[model samples]
Target: MINSTIKHLTFITLIIIGFSISFTSCYYDVEQELYPKPIDNGISCDTSTATFSVKIYPLIQSKCNSCHSTAISSGGVSLEGYNNVLSAQQNGSLMGTINHSNGYNAMPQGAGKLSDCEIANLNTWIHAGALNN
Candidate 1:
C-alpha cells in the first residue's frame, strides 16, 4: 500500500513538472511573437538621378512633410529637403520607420495612409537612385 501511494505521488509530481515546463515555454513563445526582431530587406533600387521637383518633392510635401518637416518636427524628425531625406536613409531611420509595423509610429498621424501608387513612385525613385534634381 505504501509503495502504491509513493508511485501515485511520483506520477502526479511528474505530471505537474511537465505542465509547468510547457506552460513556461508557451509564455516565452508568446512574448517572442509579440516582439519580433527587425529585418532588413535591403534597398529596392540602384543609383540613378530621379526628377525631384515633379516626382519626389511633391509626394514628400503632400504626404509626409506636413508633420515630418522642419516646422512641426514630429518625432524629432524632418523631411523638408532632399538632403534631409537622404540623411534619413543613411541613418537607417527612413526604412526602419516605414517598414516597421509597431516599433515606430507611422507618419502622417491621424491621416489616411499613402496610396499604393505614391509608395511605388517613392520606391522607384529610391531604387533608381535618390536624386537631387
Candidate 2:
C-alpha cells in the first residue's frame, strides 16, 4: 500500500510538471507567431508631373492657401501661386514654417496638422527643385 501511494503521488507530480512546461512553451510560441517583426522606414519619391498634381497640389490648397494666400495672408506667407511658393523656398522661409516645432502657431493654424504622408509629399516636391510644372 505504501509503495502504491508513492507511485500515485509521483505520477501526479510528473503530470503537473509536464503541463506547466507545455503551457509556458506554448505562450512563447504564440508570442513569436503573433509578432513577426517590424520593417524599416522606406520612403521613395517619383519626380513626375502627375505625382505633383495628384499628391502635392491638393496638400497645398487644403493645408496652406487658406491662411497663407493673397486674400487672407496669415503670417505674411502667401502660398497662393507657384511664384509665392518658390519665393518662400528661395528665402528659406517656407521650410521654416512647415517645419516649425511649435504646434499652436504653425501654418494652417487652429486645424489638424497635415499627415506624415502629406508632409513627405511636400518635402519630396521641395527637394525635387520645387518645380512649377
**Best model per TM-score:** 2
Give the distance in Å from residue 22's predicted Cα in candidate 1 to where it truly belongs: 74
TM-score of 1: 0.54
Instruction: Write model 1 residue lDDT over 73-95, tens digit each, in one string.
Output: 88788889999888886776765
After superposing candidate 1, which stretches have Cα over 4 Å from the reference?
Answer: 1-50, 99-102
TM-score of 2: 0.55
TM-score of each model, paired residue for residue: 0.54, 0.55
- Cα lDDT tens digits, model 2, 26-72, are 87455535554322123433434424467666777887887888998
- Least accurate stretch of 10 residues (summed lDDT) in model 1? 38-47
